[model samples]
Target: MPQEFSRTERVADYLQQELAKLLLHSVRDPRAEFVNITAVDVSRDLRYAKVYYTKLGVESAEAATDVTRVLDKAAGFLRTEVAKGSSLRTVPKLTFKFDESVGRGRHMEDLLGRARASDALRGNEAEADDS
Candidate 1:
């Protein structure tokens, strides 16, 4: 019978959980304090993993950069911790990436709101002309 999830998917899920715990309690960098792991993608061979993360309290570009820098620097230590916590033969190399989807979504929402407001104003103007 075919399995629902492949080994790499299972490993990625496990790593995501472990990494969240490590980032929350073990990592002490102030820049990374607000960091939240959003998702993890592991390679099919299990040799590499890309970790997507976002900040909680701050939304500035500089703050995002700082968080990414801190996480990237601590990747080695985090990988070691993962190895110690898991039974995998080889822990995947960690790569930290700032997740921009949240920001993009917010921007899109703002644009949509502006468009709606403009449409409503135009509709009111058309009614005034019709009267």
Candidate 2:
């Protein structure tokens, strides 16, 4: 059988976990606060990594930009920190991206809820007509 996960995928998983910890306790920038790493995509050659994150506790467009800037500026430092924990020959260049899926998911849920309410209201009206 082939390997369950390719080298790039394994690296991505490792980066996601280590980056989360580093951002949680190692990074001291206030702008970097509340960063949650949703996923990491490592290039097939392992030369680059794109980290997807979401801001917690008062997320805003401006705040998201600030967090992205801070993370990008600190990419070298984060990479070094990550290197200390892994045996890879070279650490991938880090790139931070604000994960929009979470926000989209919330929006989808809101739309679904409204649809359910509308269906319920229609059901009540039908019952009244039947009485």
Candidate 3:
């Protein structure tokens, strides 16, 4: 027999994989184009699953409520499909959250690049002035 993963871990894994797949092709909503699930967290009792996601190419990156509505609409379908392979007693409810870490990281990198350029320009000016 295969080793059984903990309930929470299994749920998390299922949500991550299944939701990712569902978002790729099954979902018909235009709003989903900018959304991508980054991570999933399932409750110990399998009552809830928190999905961390990010918005790509969208201004303001929207909010959790946006994903929540999509998740709410998709939950029944996700649960039904997830239950097909999972032996767990219950499939947790899906809750989507906007994960901004990706955007934040890109912003930080841009800031660093600008700082480096400024420093280089300053160094060049100082050397010119000393000549």
In candidate 1, position 1 carries an lDDT of: 95
TM-score of 2: 0.94
Model-by-model lDDT, in order? 0.88, 0.91, 0.77
lDDT of 2 at 51: 95
lDDT of 1 by residue, 15-131 (tens): 889999999999998778867788899998889999988888655555678778888899999999999987899999999888888888888999999999999999999999999
Per-residue CA lDDT of model 2 for 1-131, tens digit only, reads: 99999999999999999999999999999888888999999998999999999988634555588789999999999999999989999999999988888887888899999999999999999999999
Error (Å) of candidate 2 at residue 84 is: 1.6
Candidate 2: give the clashing pairs.
none
Best-matching candidate per TM-score: 2
Poorly placed runs, candidate 1 (over 4 Å): 57-63
Candidate 3: give the clashing pairs: none
Best by lDDT: 2
Q: Alpha carbon lDDT of residue 32, candidate 2?
A: 89
> What's model 1's lDDT at 125?
100
